[model samples]
Target: MGVLTGKTALVTGASRGIGRGVAERLGRDGPRIAVHYGSDKTAAKETVAAIEAAGGSAFAIGVRLGMPGDADRLWEEFDRHADGLDILVHNAGIGTSRPFAEIGEEEFDRLFAVNVKAPFFLTRLGAERLRDGGRVVNISSGLARAAAMPQLIAYAMTKAALDVFTRDLSKELGPRGITVNSVAPGIVDTDVNAAWLRASEEAWQEAAALAALGRVGTPADIADVVAFLVSEDGRWVTGHWLDATGGSLT
Candidate 1:
């Protein structure tokens, strides 16, 4: 039997990239999944098809984060799709390459709305409805800690805020037999990042040099960690910032 058998999971931002990877991997464990996307209907449907083909359960749902009553709409989708939730992965986020000085109010507001605000509200709503001993996994980035790129200041800021939320939410949720934690990844190779990875080998090598593993990370790399955290085996872990960064911080 799989680790998360008979459970339900809701993964936001499952249209592509790391979020899609996580949802696909977790479906192997036999949990009914509600895959949420902003607007990529086709991508979301493809995810659903893949899951069903593999004999796993999944459904596509959509919501525009930062909209009024977004929480209500999100919960409605979950309720209509699944009876209850056992795991919630807050993986929806956006980041730009704009420098801090060049960052505009709209950009900051947009990122925060998705990266920070939506997660917070979703967690609040999810916690109340989640079964006892539920798990909440928030996808953070190593950039929150080592956000050295000048062009990534705003993105890093949102992640840093997410870290704080992860910690505080864990404390509040712990007493309810629920666990909350964050997973930070460094440079995972995925379609969304193909442009960057397609660059010069020298540039790639420089980036890889920072990783103790001497290579770049893959979507599966981060997904595996998230799957473990959402499983029964991860019960004792909570309020942690687990690094799936190939020991980049080590």
Candidate 2:
């Protein structure tokens, strides 16, 4: 039997990248999965199908992560698909690399809405249905503590805010037996990083150099850490970031 057998998990932005990888890994333990997507309907369906083919229970739902009323619609679909919630993964986020001086108010709002506000409210919604001893893993970035890179101020700010949420909420949820934590990934090779990956050999090599592992990260790398964090072995871990960063922050 899977470690998570009979559990229900909701993974936002699960249509692709690290989220997709985590969803697939968790499905190995026989948990029902709600794969939430923003614009990639086909990709989301494909991910769900893959899970089902692997003998796991899974389905896809759509919502614009940063839009008004999106959270309500997402929660409603989640209710229909899941019997109850045990694990909640806030994996949906957007990244921008514009100059700080050029960042308009609208851009800032949009970035925070998706990267911060959506996850905050989702955590609230999940906490209501989350069983005692449930798990919440907020996907953050290594950038939270890393030396600043170009065009990532607002994005990093949003993730940095999540660290606080994880730390503070761990204390609040301790009595309930629920564990809250964040996973900060470094230079993960996802479509979101495709532009950088394909930018030039030098750029890719530089990313690799930053990692002690000497390579940019794959979705599976981050997923493996997440799987551990939400598993029985992770019982003693909470209110901390497992730092899936390949030691880049070091």
C-alpha lDDT score of every prediction, in listed order: 0.89, 0.89
Residue 34 error, candidate 2, Å: 0.7
Top-TM-score structure, candidate number: 2
Q: What is the C-alpha lDDT profile of model 2 across 109-202, one tens digit per residue?
A: 9999999899888877667888998999999998899997658898899999988999998998889988999999999889988997879999
Which parts of model 1 are misplaced by more than 4 Å? none
lDDT score of residue 64 within candidate 1: 78
Error of 2 at 100 (Å): 1.0
Superposed Cα deviation of residue 48, candidate 1 (Å): 1.0
Which window of ten consecutive residues has the lowest lDDT sum in model 1? 189-198
Q: What is the C-alpha RMSD of each candidate to the true structure, in Å?
A: 1.2, 1.1
- Candidate 1 matches the true fold with a TM-score of 0.96
What would the C-alpha RMSD of candidate 1 be, to one decimal place? 1.2
User: Per-residue alpha-carbon lDDT of model 1 for 1-250, expressed as tens digits?
Assistant: 7778799999999989898999999999999888899999999999988888888999999997876688789999888877789999999888798897898998889999889989998888777789989999999999999738889988988999999998998889898889989999998787767777768887788778889999989888999999888887899999999988998887
